[model samples]
Target: MAVTLQSLETKGLPPVNDWHPDFCGDIDMRICSDGHWEYMGSPIGRESMVRLFSTVLRHDDDGHFYLVTPVEKVRIRVDDAPFIAVSVEQISHQHVFTTNVGDKVILNPQHPLRLSDEGAGVPYILVRDRLEARIHRNVYYELVNRAELRMLDGQEQLCITSGDHYYSLGMILEQD
Candidate 1:
């Protein structure tokens, strides 16, 4: 299938609760003027955005977030030593809230997470210094960018970083 100016212009997921249509069970990618990639139709921008806006599967009943990273080397900078950070855990489903990660707890749909840079060199998502998102498989997982993504907002901002690029996330931003 082809993602045209029309489809690209159609913001947001099509009223369907689940995007998996009968014809295309699971479209893992999108193709547009940008180019070809895993998360095809996603916007592009920022180093942090790349880590936040990848493939958003579904905010499952498990009470955590899930997604797949199409890119690699999620960078983690620290006070003592900053270096390219690779995911310790497999890039599958994971939690976004835990002790080692501040022991902070913010439930989705209940609270709007507050993001803060604690100098942990860890990854995070936020609205404005508030940690609003996390990783969740057995727990709340941090959301990271797998591929480049578009915000799907009117502007359709790019939310990924490859040397010198940025973007916005296309996944669902939990309703509060």
Candidate 2:
């Protein structure tokens, strides 16, 4: 049967943070590193279905991602981050990020940006709770283009300012 928007829940995002549902075992669902959602080793081609599922997704303290509801919680595999920061826009002193799942996050103290050692020192921004969205290479470059070289900790660093916080993109290596 084809997945339809009407077939999925029409209600707004549930209070997943408040729900204490029982484990419903693992599901063959996977969010690939490229930010594609898959089910049973196949891609979930429905954008609406993916969006609905994204709202209910949660990353628990146990270091596992889950599709949660008031009644049950099912584990899912995430190769990297559950969301990807596909684009970014700079607004005055703040930068607004748009994720693949349509989450708009402002880079600030609450939604701070942090560098990841994996994938050649890629960056990630906190979307909600403990979940983060990996910054796409193109978007990351946009940030770098707007970044300023500052002396931090006695080293030249490329940093970006968002709100009142200064986030370092990375260090600038000296030429030999």
Candidate 2 clash figure, as a count: 0
lDDT of 2: 0.87
Worst 10 residues of 1 by lDDT: 76-85
Off by over 4 Å in 2: 1-12
| Model 1 stretches with alpha carbons more than 4 Å out | 1-95, 99-107, 111-144, 158-176
Largest TM-score belongs to which candidate? 2
lDDT by residue (102-175, candidate 1, tens digit) is: 22322222223222356432233331122233322222122343434465455543243322233232343455
- Candidate 1's error at 99, in angstroms? 5.0
| Cα RMSDs, all models | 19.7, 7.2
